[model samples]
Target: MASKVMMTPGEILREGELEKRSDSLLQLWKKKRGVLTDDRLRLFSGTSERAKELRFHSILKVDCVEHTRKYVYFTIVTTDYKEIDFRCTEESCWNAFITLALIEYQNRRAVEGFRRHRFQRVASEEQQEEPGEQRALSPW
Candidate 1:
């Protein structure tokens, strides 16, 4: 059994078996089951030493979330144009959790970007003006 590793910082929004579709010519349509985390999706073939990690930022989108009688299926499309399919039991709702986590991650990044831009702008404005001509800070 592979001992679990501690999560670095981000809260794990979801974790479970996400069977990844193999892209090798030999495996063709073969699926490899592995553990999925909010920050990265990893697959290990019988040993933790062989784990493969796919980070969330590298993922372009989660598409084709559908379900059959047995399982819910979805595809993760990476920025590099790689498509990895995953299937989980219907009750797991892996698709919904991944979508929500991706959205939240994007929102956090946008807010941080805006804050950085605003800080730079304010600093530049202050630098351009003389100390005596500095504008009063707004109460808001």
Candidate 2:
């Protein structure tokens, strides 16, 4: 049976190793330790340095490119249209975890945005009402 991948709300999502395609003349595949958080995906190099970060707010979508018998290849498209390619073992479900975490982060952001907009609208409406306006009391 296939394993299920789930995201932790408002927390670090997942951490694992992923093979990323480099943007060099040779275009080599390098191993990276990926830490998926609620707000960003942080990648660390095999050595001592932290490599790259892909924030969820700037990430547009995750696209699955291909699935071979041994690995799953996917691409992450950023809001600025930067495409990052990644591959992982088939059983690791890296693609699924990334997709799910991205969606959850987006949904949370949408809800927070809606709340802010609604609050601002309500406040504006309240301010627009004449301060000295009188209202009849409801007969209880």
Candidate 3:
């Protein structure tokens, strides 16, 4: 069984400021407060409310675009096929944080799925072995 900390969702893993590339035509760089949780990565502006959310369930993968002297660039690819670009200082390691969190989320999901499947199989087997139930004999 997985530990409580690894299995639990909604736990805050990392939080910091990151610069994201805008999705509009101008495609300018905008600052965002990024929060990496066990299940999702949320981006917020100066306001208290979240501006954008990329849930782990909807995220396909995170890829490194490039790494420069000052910044490490990366992209978050969503399940819907949308690409979101971001960059942060090399020391900050925003990209690494997100990638690790995403991997952990995926692992948790896989563990849950395996557990559910195993439980269902066990329950089905138990039903077949119910008390007072008898197996049919061969005609031969």
Candidate 4:
């Protein structure tokens, strides 16, 4: 029989070596696909004081940049997570967002690698649709 072990967002992030890997902050969005404990979600969702301090709400989005035949790069969007009317200290929020962004980037990198190996003939704009339309038809 296998024993069950629970994981936290912090643990997952730390295990990936996200902090030491780059100068920027990192955040990984582990949804239903990844194993996450309720505690981890609570920590990430900012229900507790510690979570709030981490600036969980400061994350806006993560963008992956794909270069031809090159590794995908991640950029994290930063915002103020604080709900008060007053302005937040730029340093704290900025750092938090960056950290989260880095983690998310690392996570994306792993996923992208897995997908590339699993799927052949990955859809590209050039291959999927006919010319003359401004936008390519996305299966999404």
In order of appearance, the predictions have TM-scores of 0.72, 0.84, 0.85, 0.24
Local lDDT at 62 for model 1: 87
Among the numbered candidates, top TM-score falls to 3
Give the number of colliding residue pairs in candidate 3: 0
- At residue 90, give the lDDT of candidate 1: 83
Candidate ordering by lDDT (highest first): 3, 2, 1, 4
RMSD (CA, Å), candidate 1 to true, equals: 7.8
**Model 1: residues >4 Å from true position, as ranges?**
1-8, 26-38, 131-140
**Taking the tens digit of each residue's C-alpha lDDT, what string does model 2 give over 25-77?**
88899999988887888899887585688888899999999999999999999
- Compared with the true structure, the alpha-carbon lDDT of candidate 4 equals 0.36
Candidate 4's residue-wise lDDT over 1-61, tens digit each? Answer: 9995654455543211111122225533321111122212222222223332223344445
TM-score of 2: 0.84
What is residue 126's positional error in candidate 1, in angstroms? 1.2
lDDT of 2 at 34: 89
Query: Can you list the residue pairs that collide in candidate 1?
Result: none
The lDDT for every candidate, in the order shown, is 0.71, 0.88, 0.89, 0.36
lDDT (10s digit) by residue, model 1, range 1-140:
99956545555556556565566676344344455555666666644457677787898888967789888888988999988887777887777777776766677678999999999999998777755354445333
Better of 1 and 4 by TM-score: 1
